[model samples]
Target: MNDLPAFLLRKADEYNAPSFIPADPICVPHSFSKKQDIEIAGFFAAIFAWGNRTTIIGKTKELMALMGNSPHNFILHHKEKERERLLGFKHRTFTATDLLWFVQVLQQHYQRYDSLETAFFPTPVKAQEHAVKHGLIRLQQTFFSTPGAPMRTRKHLSSPERNSGCKRLNMFLRWMVRHDNSGVDFGLWKNIAPADLIMPIDLHVARVAKRFGLMERKLPDWQAAEELTAYFRTIDPEDPVRFDFALFGLGVLEKF
Candidate 1:
C-alpha cells in the first residue's frame, strides 16, 4: 500500500471479483472420471487461449470433441449428461493435433490412474516437471514436458511456437481452474495458492500494465510476471490472480 501506483491501488475498490466463473476446463479424464465431468470437458475447451481468437476457437471445439462430446453437437449436449464418450476418429475436427497428442499421452501415462491432482501435481516442482520426468516429452514431437523445468508462463515465451504452447496451456488452466461450469472440479489445485501461481502476461496487457505503471521493466519474461504478480500480491496475497480480470480487461478494453 505504501508504494503502490495510484491507479492500481484504486482497483481494490473498483472491481468485484466474481465468486466463481466456471472452472470447467481443468478437469481431466483421470481426475474427472467421477464428478462434474462437464467442467472437465469445458476444461478441455480452448476458451481464453492467448492468440488470435479465430485459431483458438477451432482448437477449442476440437478439444471438446476429443473430450468425448459429439463433434456434431456444437451446443455442448454432453455438458448436461457428463457421459464418458470418446471422439471416434472418423468424426474428428476442430481440435489441435498437439492437444490430442497430449490427451493420448495422458491416456497412456495415467491409464490406470485418475485425478489430475494426484496424477499430476503437489510435488516439489510444478506439474510440467513431472510431465517431463514421466517421459511426456517423449510423447511430444519435439519439446518434451520435463520435471523441475521452467513453466510456460506469459513471460517465458521464446518463439511463436512456444508462445502458442503457452497459450494452449493457459487457456486450459483458465478453463480448468477459475472457470466453474465447464466441467468437474478436480479439486487438486484447491489447496494450492496463487502466490504459487504465475501470471500469463501477453503483449497487449503487458503494454497496458506498463502504461498504467503496473509494471515498468522493459524486457518481458519470467521476471516481468514475477514483478507484476508481486505487486498484485500486495493487494491480495492469497489470490493475486483475482486481479487478473481487472488487469486483462483494462488492457483488452483499452481503459486508462
Candidate 2:
C-alpha cells in the first residue's frame, strides 16, 4: 500500500493531460472557453456518459450543434417556438421530453444565478464532510422543483438519498471544482473545495478499487463510493478524488 500513492500519481499524471480530452466526454466542455458554456456542456456530457465514449461525445456535440453551439445563450434566451428543433433529440433513454425539462430548469436557474454552482449550495450554511452528498440531494430537488417535470427524468439524476453511486453528477462536480494545471478538469467553481468532492464511481472504478483493496463493498452504491473515497483520502487528504484519473486510466485505458 505504501507504493500505491506513487503508482496513482504516475498514472494520474499520465492520463490527466490534454491528449486525454479529445477521446473522452470531457471534450464536449473543452470545446467552449466561456464558463457558463463549459458548465452547461459539461453537465450534458456527464449525464450522457453511460455508454460508449464515442457515442457520448458524438451525442453531446450534436446537442451543442442544435443549440447553435452557444448553449448558455440558447438556454437563457431561445424562444419556446425555437425549442421545436430539440423535439426529436434523443440519447439512449434521455428523450426529447427530458431534454426540454432540463433546458427549462437550467433557464430558470441561470436567470437568478450567474453560475450553476449556486444550485449545489442551496443554503448558506457550510457542510464540511458531506458537502457533495448534500449538494447532490439539493441539486435533484432543484432540478425537479418545476411543475410538470417528467417522472422518467428522475432516473437520469442520481443522489445519495437513493443509495445511488451518483457517478455522473459527481463527475460533473469534479470537472467544475477540482483545480489543477492539467488542462483537463475545468476547476471553475470555488465554493466547494476539492477535498469535499466525492469519487465518481462506475463499474470500472469499482472493480479497480476493490482489486486495489481500497474498497471492500460488493455493491457499487453510494456507500461504496463513499468508502472508496475515504480510503483515497488517506493517500491524499486534500485532493483524494484526483486519484479518479488514475483509477479510470488504469481500468479503461490500461485495462488493469
In the range 1-256, model 2's lDDT, one tens digit per residue, is: 7698799888888998989999999999998999999999999999999989999999999999999999999999999898999999999999999999999999999999999999997444344878888899989999997788899999999989999999999999899988888889998898878888889999999889888888888888999989888888888888888989999999998898
Model 1 residue 72 lDDT score: 24
With a 3 Å backbone cut-off (N, CA, C), the pairs that clash in candidate 2 are: none
Instruction: List ranges where model 2 is wrong by over 4 Å.
Output: 122-127
Which parts of model 1 are misplaced by more than 4 Å? 1-43, 46-48, 54-58, 70-97, 123-188
Model 1 C-alpha lDDT per residue in residues 1-256, reported as the tens digit of each score: 3555455545523432332222222322333343334434444443334455445445555555565553223222334233323333221332233333434434434444343433323343343312322321222322235343223321321222332223334333333344233222223354233345545567765777787677787755556765776777776765555455566556654454
The whole-model lDDT of each prediction reads: 0.43, 0.91
* lDDT score for residue 139 of model 1: 21
Task: Score candidate 1 by lDDT.
Answer: 0.43
Shift of residue 76 alpha carbon in model 1, Å:
19
Provide the clash count, candidate 1. Answer: 33
